[model samples]
Target: MFPTIGDLISYIFHVNAKVNLQTFGSCMALAFAGAYVVFVAEFKRKENDGTISIVKVKTASKTMEVIVNACIGFLIGYKVVAILLALWQGQDPVALLFSLRGNWIAGGGLAFVWGIWAYSTHKAMASQFIHPYQLMPYIVFMVAVWGFIGAKLFDAVEHFQELLYNPVTVLFSRSGFTYYGGLIFGALTYLYIGYRHKIKLIHMADIGSPGMMLAYGIGRIGCQLSGDGDWGIVNRHIKPGWIPQWAWAYTYPHNAINAGVFKQGYYELPAGVYPTPLYEAVLCILLFLGMWMVRKRLRVPGAMFFLYLVLNGVERYYIEILRVTPKYTLFQLSQAQMIALLFMAGGVAGFVWLTGRSYFSSTKQIP
Candidate 1:
C-alpha cells in the first residue's frame, strides 16, 4: 500500500521527490468528493419525490459572489503559493507546508488581482430556486470542523497520560484521532445545521447514511496504509495457504507513525500483526454498497440511518476482538466495544420506534 503520494510517485516515475502527500488526507479528500456527488444525487432524488421544496431568492448580488469567490481564491493561493515556492527551493514539501512560512506578498498580490477581475466579470442572474446541493459545502465545512475537534478531544482523553506528560505535543501532533468521537460530534453538528436550514432531521440522517459509510471505508484505507497503530494483536499463528500472508498478518515496515516498539536485535518490530484496518475497510465498503442499494426502498425516514448504525456497531464490535486495545475490568471489553454496544442498542430502539409509529399511522389512515 502507498502510504503517501511521494512514495507512490517515486515507485512509478523513479524520481526522488521527497514530498509527503499523506494517504489519510488523500482518502479524506476522495471521501468528501464521493460524499458530495452522492449528496447531490440524493438531494435531486428527494426533490423529484416532492419531499422538499427549493427556495428561490428574489434577487442576488454579484458583489457577494465575487467577495466569497475572492476570499476562497486568496486562502488557496496563500498556502499553495508558499508550498510551491518551497518545492522549487528543494525544501521538503510536507515540512514547508506544515511550517509557519509563506510568500505572503506574492499570494496577497495575486489574490487582489484575481478579486478585481472576478468583480468586473461578475453578473447578477435571474432568480432561481436554490438547490439543496448548494448548501453541501457549508454542511461539509461544519462537519469537518466539529469532527476534527471531537476526534482530537476524544483521542486526548484516551491517552490522558501522554497528554499530561507532553501537553503541547499531544494536542498539536498530527495523529491520535478517534473515529467514533468524530462521528458523534460531527453528526450532532450536521443535524443542528440541517435543523437551522428547516430540514427534517430524519430525512437528513437518511441522506447521509450511505455517504458516511463510504467515507468510513475510505478513511480505514488511510489507517491501513499508514499503519497508524490501528492494527490488531500480533498474529504468531501460521497463515493458511488459501489466505494471502499480507491479508492475514503484516509487518508494517517504514510505517508512517514509525512505531518501532519491538526490538529483538534490530530496531524494527520482529513479528507481524493482524491487519484489522484492511478488514474494516473492506467490510465498510460492502456495507456502504448495500445501504446505497436499499436506501430508496426504506420508506421509514430514519430506518436507513438506524440500520447503518447497527451494521457499523456490529462491525466495530467484532473487529475489537482481534484488535489490541486497553480494556475495562468490568466486562473485559474495550472502550470501543462498550460504545459499539450503545450504538447497536440505540439503533435498535430507534428503528423499532420509527417502524411502530409508521405502522400505527398507516393503520389509522385505513378506510
Candidate 2:
C-alpha cells in the first residue's frame, strides 16, 4: 500500500527519522564490529601469553579486521551525521539514538548489538581452538537464521494480526523481510567470526563464494513464494499486451483465509517490472564462477571480495530501473542507483590498478 520509500518509512514505523529494515540491519552490523574488536583484542593477547603458542593472526585475519573496522567506523560516522542533521532540526539526537529506554523491541535492537559483540569476542579469544574456515559456514548460517527472524519480527510488529493468528509463523514466514537486512547483518556476522578466528578471507571468500550466491538465490525464492510484497510491476503501458496478466498479478488470501489483510485488493506491480532479485541470484552465480576459476590468478589481498562488490553493484544498478521502492532523487536518480554507481566506480578503479600491476610484473625480466 505504501508506494514510496518515504511513505514506507512513515507508514511502517510512523517515524520521519528515515529508519527502516536497513537501519535495523545496520545496527546488527555495528554489533558485529563491536564483537570483532573485542575478539581481536582478547584473542591476540591470549595467543601471545598462551603456553602452547598455537594462535596466529594470519593475513586473512588482519584483512578481515581492517575491513570490518573501516565498515564500523563508517557506520558510526554516519550515525553521528544523522545526529547532527536531527539537531539542526531541533531534535534531541541523543534521545533518539537511545530511544530503547521504554520499548522492549528497541531494547532488543540494542541488546542484539551488545549480545553478538560480547559472545563473538568471547569465542574469538578461544578461536585458536578451532579451524578458522571451518567455523565460518556455521556463523553465516546463524546469521541467515537470525537475520530472517529479526526482519520477520519487525514486519509482524507492523502487521500485528499476522502474529496473532499463527504466532509460530513469525519464525517460519517467508517474504515479509527485507534483503538488505539479511545481507548487512549476515555479512557482518561472517566478517566478525572470520576475523576473530583469523580465517583467510581471500581464500575463504573463494571457498564460500558459491554459498553466498546460493544463499541469496534461495532467500529470493522465499520472497517469491510468500509474495510478501516484493513483486515487480507489470508495465501495462510499455509492454502493452506483451506482458502476461499473471506476470504482475498476485492474489493474497482473502480475509477469511489469513490473519488479516494489511492491504486490500491484490497488489498490482508496476508494469514491465523485472524479477531483479532472481536475476541478481543468477548473476551472482555467474560472477562466483568467474571468481572461483581465477581464485589463484591474483596474489593481491581482497581481490575476490573487491570483484564481488563490482558484480553486486552492477547487478543492483541494472535492477533498480525496474524496482518500485521509494527513493531520494539526486539528479533524478534513486539513492540505490547512486550507490551502485559508486560501487562500480570503486570496483573499476581497483580492478584496473590491480591488473595493471600484474600485467607489468608479468612482462618484467626475472634473473
Candidate 3:
C-alpha cells in the first residue's frame, strides 16, 4: 500500500522525495469532488421541480469585497510563503507548515499584493447572481471541515486514556476519526445551511444521500491504502484455492501508522489480518449505485433519505462483526454497532410514517 504519493513518485523516479501527498487526504479530496458533482445534479433536479428558488449573487460593497479578498490572500500567502521558505532552507516542509515558523514579513507583503489584485479584478468583472446550487462546493467544504472536527472529538472521547496521556498527539494526529461522529455533525451543519437558504430539509437530505454514500466508499479506499489500523482481527483460516490471497487476508507492511506487531525475522507484521476496509469500500460503492438508481423513482421526498439511513446502518453494523474494535460486552456490540441500530430504527420509523402519510393523502384526493 502506498501511504503517500511521494512514496509512489519515489519508486517511479528512483529518487527520494520529501513531499508527503497522503493517500487518505488525496482520497478525501476526490470524495469531496465526487460529492460536489452529485450535489450539483441533485440541486438542479430540485430547482427544476420547483422545490427551491434559483440563487442570485448580489454585488458586494467595495469594503466588503476588499476585506474578504484580504482574508483569503492572507491565508494563501501565509501557507505558500511558509512552504517556499521551508524548501529554500532545506527544512521539512510539512513540519514548517504545521508549525509557527512562517516568514511573517514575506507573508504579509504577498497578502497585501494578492488582496489588491483580487479587489481590482472583482471591480472589473460584471456581477451576476448565480443559482443557489452553484454554492454546493462551498457547502460541501464547510461540511467536511466540521465533520473532521467532530470525528476527531469523538475519537478523543473513545480513547480517553490515550488522550489524557498525550493530549497533543491525540488531538493533532491525522488519524483516529470516528465515522458516526462525522456524520452527525455534518448532518447538523447541512441542516442549518439548508434551513438558512430556505431549502426543504427533507429534500436536502435526499439530495445528499447518494453523495454521502459515495464519499464514504471513497474514503474507505484510503483506509485500505494506508492501513491505518482499520483492519480486522487475525484471520488464521486457509484461503480456498479459487480465492485470491489479498482478498482473504493481508499483512499490511509499511502502513502509514506503522501499526501491527513485528514477527521473529520480518520488520513487518507476520500474521495476516482481514482487510476490512477493502470490503467496506466495495460494499459501499455497490450500495451507492443502488441508491442512485432508485433516487428519482422513490417519489416521496424523504423516502430516499430514510432508505439511505437504513442501508448505511445495515452495512456498518454487519461490517463491524468482522472488525476488531473494542466491544461493549454487556450489550454484545461495539459502540458503532449501537449507533447503527439507532439509525436503522429511525430510518424504518420515518419511512413508514412518510409513506403512510403519502398514501392517505392520495386516497383523500381520490374522491
TM-score of each: 0.86, 0.49, 0.87
Candidate 2, 242-292: lDDT as tens digits:
745334443323211232334456343332344454455456656656665
Q: Which model, 2 or 3, shows the larger lDDT? A: 3
Top TM-score hit? 3
Candidate 3 lDDT (Cα, 0 to 1): 0.81
Order of the predicted models by lDDT, top scorer first: 3, 1, 2
Q: What TM value does model 3 have?
A: 0.87
Candidate 1 wrongly placed segments (more than 4 Å)? 11-19, 56-72, 86-98, 110-128, 261-268
RMSD of 3: 3.3
Better of 1 and 3 by TM-score: 3
* Candidate 3 per-residue C-alpha lDDT over 1-367 given as tens digits, one digit per residue, 9 for 90 to 100: 6677666677779888765657777787888888888888988987887877765445777777787777767776778777766655555465664566666776688778877876777754446656768877668868988998899998887788899999999888757899888988998898788887667899889988999999999999988887778888888998999978878888887787777665553234568889999999999999999998987788778888899889999999999998988787678898789999998998999989997898999999985
Over the stretch 1-367, how does candidate 1's per-residue lDDT look in tens digits? 4567676678789998676667667777887788888877887787789776674544447777667767766766777887777656655555665566667776677678778887887656766567776778888888988998898887887778899999888777777888888988988998887787677888888888888888889888888876777889989898999999889988876676677654553234457889999999999999999998898898767888899889999999999999987777779998788889998998999988987898999999999
Candidate that beats the other on TM-score, 2 or 3, i.e. the better one: 3
Model 2 lDDT, full chain set = 0.50
Clashing pairs in 2: 5-326, 233-269, 233-270, 234-270, 234-271, 234-272, 235-271, 235-272
Which of candidates 1 and 2 reaches a greater lDDT? Answer: 1
The 0-to-1 C-alpha lDDT of every candidate, in the order given, reads: 0.80, 0.50, 0.81
